[model samples]
Target: MIRPRRPERKAPPLLPPLKLYKAILRTHVHKLPIELRSLGDEYVKAEFKAHQNIDNPLHIVGFLTQWQDYLKNLDGGSWQEGKLSQEDLDKMSPEQVNQLYELMLETKRLGSEG
Candidate 1:
């Protein structure tokens, strides 16, 4: 017997990179606290700059997808309550994990200094 074919799921539309970057910086980042706004802006700028030359479609999609989720969370006022899921942590490379750890430490230090 032949198996029935299932329809492929479609991903929601994403903003183009420059548009998304501007949206994050111009709209979302302004809603953050002063210190956090500075940090968030710098981080977003650096990440976008770093990925500007990336040629892989999958990597670009994943990068944009994550940033888009962040934008959505900020818009919905749940960004502070966000936590990394185990599945997401499992997907990170060692370097990415280290970077996340460092960012955590920096945020903690900023919190302490405030």
Candidate 2:
């Protein structure tokens, strides 16, 4: 007898748009410098508004994942002109410190050229 194929798994339901919107803005934009904060808020609002009618689970997940990563980079200061604070450096292991140093050098090199 031939074995039956397993059904494909479905993605979990997405958080409601307003809920996700509030969370992202609260977590990602509230603390930014005034001018930049407003700009970021507007961009996020526009993007979310544009995607409001998206019904595909895959696309919604991808959009949420992309914004979550953006929030993480903003919170971690990884994209804050690629600069790490002395306090943050002091908390890292020697290996991490070395990695951060290398990353900073690479960012600085690219920053100068671009």
After superposition, which runs of candidate 2 have C-alpha atoms over 4 Å from their true positions? 1-16, 28-30, 82-114
Best-performing candidate as measured by lDDT: 1
Mind giving the per-residue lDDT tens digits that candidate 1 earns over 8-64?
898779999999998898765467877677878888998999999999999999999
TM-scores of all predicted structures = 0.86, 0.51
RMSD in angstroms, all models?
A: 3.4, 13.1
Instruction: Looking at model 1, report the run of 10 residues with the lowest lDDT sum.
Output: 27-36
Clashing pairs in 1: none
